[model samples]
Target: MYVRHVAAAAAAFLGWALVLSGGPATTATAAASGESTTAAAATGRDPVRLVGAPVLYAHRGASAYAPENTLAAVDLAEDLGIDWVENDVQRTKDGELVVIHDDTLARTTDVETRYPDRKPWRVADFTAAEIAGLDAGSWFTPQFAGARVPTLRQYLDRVRFNQQKLLLEIKKPELYPGIEQDTLRVLEEAGWLGEQQVENRLVVQSFSVDCVRTVHSLRPDLITAFLGTPAAEDLALYAEFTDRINPWHTTITAEWVAAVHALRGVHGEPLEVDTWIVDDPAVARKVQAMGVDGIITNAPDVVREAVGGF
Candidate 1:
């Protein structure tokens, strides 16, 4: 079933490429032009590998510089000239998709103080309006005091408005049952499910194998990534559905990367490897040297500077 979906994805990707005749704006150029950040897909290749250096996705939108998953974080990432931003998605009680990392609100927002009896403060326990009322950024710093937790709709528009690409992770899908469908609906509503966006500007991912598979089965056109490294023996199986295999930096090596790249993704192109959460310059250089395709970092400026040969 996964292999069969590739034919459909290929046709869609090729049609869009022929219509456009070239790739969308490059990340750096897109940053300046407010254009989509997806590169065009040629006949049999995947739309990836922008300009040689590993593409840098500001983890949770430059979390080191601003409150994570907040609009301010994405804005800070764009201000730093990083064109790719990664974010986490969860559902509120009202079924509205929202961008926030923790399942609960205490760590990132002042939910505990606002609703003192709401002990756990799980995001799903609150309505969209209630979640929006909490201050999501003040915990990081007072200057970001009023940054409300953005609904996924708001987050998508902000990224689109900024002309940046997204690596959107469907966080803890099991807890939200049917969230994969909800997410696709929201992405479609935001125009993110369009072929061009799927081919170039968007990638939906999850640490959950079932969630990742569900996304692919539902809409293979969207590029998808699995958040952790699967067993070497399982790489082929994962490639059938996921375009990228992203793992923590410490768990990979040149050989491992080669093994993954040796296989083809659902789009009939080699699977890519992008490692995560690497905040230190030295560690960023380490992963770059290991031949990983991209680095997810809190400081895109620091990592971009650390890894030479742009």
Candidate 2:
């Protein structure tokens, strides 16, 4: 199923690329930019490499244990001793960057009863203050009755306080204009970039090439990742912008990982290959053996244990 999705999405994007470029071989120079991997890529001087091969990343905190994206989830992930925790960031109506997975508040929040007038309950429709008032936890279970959505500052503080690294995703960035700059601004003000710890603890990633490029251009020193499978040319271009190319785990192939690893990145470093959302320990072991550099999942404990047993 995952391989099918990857193939379908790749084909669709290829078609879109051809349409935009008026020709497949002509429009995407990035796809056709190179013949082999750079020496920099082989050096492996990336944040992802520092943690070692098969690094474990907590997805939306320990989402399997607590409400996803809530402070409770982050706390649990940190407690589990995961190498890094990942979270999604979106802009509120008032321009504050808050943490949440979905563009709408209905599934995670009691927005239907809390604000019936605000039909559709989109995240961008409400101010940070308003979003704070919504119950972000109760929906998951009765144990967490009033978990509120955390602002980017609040989320980073927790990660920093715990001395854990982060894999921050700019969710649906196209929905919020200038969000790329705003995110970089927030991180800068929060001191995440202090002493240039980007290679040590921070990775800014997004599904949107534009957002990834935006962040890379703003902070050339920081590490970035692309969360999609771009064509060969686009993959080469991604190599020029990000330190990693994270793909869905279901369809990942050893050759695919090797292909990306063979490319050089913007800082002349190796672009690591990481896969996401794998929960099964057996499946985790398979991907690791396949040479995936990192594994992003909700069950960090499960994967960590699997890694230890090896």
Candidate 3:
């Protein structure tokens, strides 16, 4: 969670910036008018209307309250009343896809203790069965000691059972060759490729431009997002294949959100911006006021309350 802590620190700094500029609520509310006026000229289309508070996505399933990418995390997010959950998917040596964040297993699981000899326990180095035998949740708390890493199939079944929406990230696709095709195969077999699921319940996202394009080409029906910001001039090309632009929260501003919203996606709907990894309420409200369409966070419950109060 070092990176999460760093993001939170950055959020605090941004919150401070909001205070110096004037309160986030008042300043952004006042800026909206000017932003709207220039929005069309900024991107060659009328501004996409800003919705209410941004939608909250449980980053790796309310990870602040549960072990990330575990079934427990998903269940906890559901318990928190968050319908949208974001998770990372990687492939094991046996070609089975699993829900985990890092290329290595040392941080989120008891891998080092389980296999002390396996120096750098990369996720792709172990077979799925080997990974399944390791405890994934004990690092978070003893209460979750036995929580095992979930296979993508198991993860999908659980999410479907809960009737939750998923922002499924294709984490580091380069490490796992042909993972895009492999992932589509899984989503198809699991019924996620169906019309309703594609339209409503799923979004496949990746930081890799090639991977995003590949997913778009393979399943044009499925909504897809690019995880990092492209150049302003590049947004049009991305909009041809991607539906949303999801950037690290620190990089977002009202102007950037407006720029993204001015373009139409492959589906003919205005492109959206969903900023990532913000866990602070002040920062949450700041981004909400910036007109972001979504906030992906480790503390979904807190953000829900924060944005609601704002």
Candidate 4:
């Protein structure tokens, strides 16, 4: 996993370099007033009319710049005026909901140094308090030496305080049975679901189809997305519950996107399509041209600037 992270980070840097060599994107929001007043106004001339702007979700809370799933990363996304930030949730050994990505704590935390004997340091092996004690940011940079793991409550508070929306991902939820219910219970306690406008501000997504079904069955009022590639039959089945079908970039195409657009959704909206981890300017523009409504990116600023929109 650490090897994968290094490879991804290196690729991201190279993509940025290629983007830098180019002059500037013609449809960038800076020229919003040149012809069409806003990104929405410009969409009519294109293949798809999105909700408002090109929706950009700061993948893993602007993970490209700051440590992923930390307050520092989320705050940086907010500071950049990004409307949406994404995060992952997993349970600790004591069944407490904490925000982190991997099933283990090797790449982003000091778990190996702190507990050398614990091979394959699974998150569920330690209590939340014990998990919280590890330094989460120093691995990224010394400037962020003391960042700690945040509880789900703290993560929700940060998102709410920023006045931003969240793409809440239930990570590896199958490992902890009934985590879907536990997640909703935590959100209910946080005033994030079941009673107010907060529900509208969240889009619950999961790679696990079972987890997606759990969220859909439990609270259909809240938006839900199915992440990863799904079979054609699976897509049709999920269309009943999921508001969006967010596949990987590799699986998406113009025809697939158009087909999804034609499908009627039970939620009274178009079968919204979104895709992830796009960073290069050329790729971002291609995604937009493919009729994708949203772009989930680690490089939020570049996507919003080069791809042009929110």
**CA deviation > 4 Å runs, candidate 4:** 1-52, 194-199, 232-234
Model 2 Cα shift for residue 130 (angstroms): 0.7
Count of residue pairs whose backbone atoms collide, per candidate: 2, 6, 0, 0
For model 3, the stretches where C-alpha displacement exceeds 4 angstroms are: 1-51
- Compared with the true structure, what per-residue lDDT tens digits does model 2 show for residues 24-91? 22111111132122332233222212123367788998888678998877777665557588999999
Where is model 2 more than 4 Å wrong at Cα?
1-53, 232-234
What lDDT tens digits, residue by residue, belong to model 4 across residues 128-205?
989999999998777668888899899999998998888899999879998999999999898888445444578889
lDDT of 1 by residue, 1-310 (tens): 1111122233223222322114343343333343333431112122222234567889899787778999988987876667889999999998999999999999999998999998899999999999999999789877678999999999999999999989999999989999999999999999887777877788888999999999999997778999998888889999888888999998887678778878999888888888898877678766665667778988775566556311
Q: What RMSD does each model have against the real structure? A: 10.1, 15.1, 12.1, 10.1
Span of 10 residues, lowest total lDDT, candidate 2:
19-28
List ranges where model 1 is wrong by over 4 Å. 1-51, 308-310
* TM-score of each model, in listed order: 0.83, 0.81, 0.83, 0.82
How many pairs of residues collide in model 1?
A: 2
TM-score of candidate 1 relative to the true fold: 0.83
Q: What lDDT is obtained when candidate 3 is compared to the true structure? A: 0.79
- CA-lDDT, candidates in order: 0.78, 0.75, 0.79, 0.75
Q: Model 1, 140: alpha-carbon shift in Å?
A: 0.4
lDDT of 3 by residue, 239-300 (tens): 98999999998887777777788888888888888889898877887887676778899876
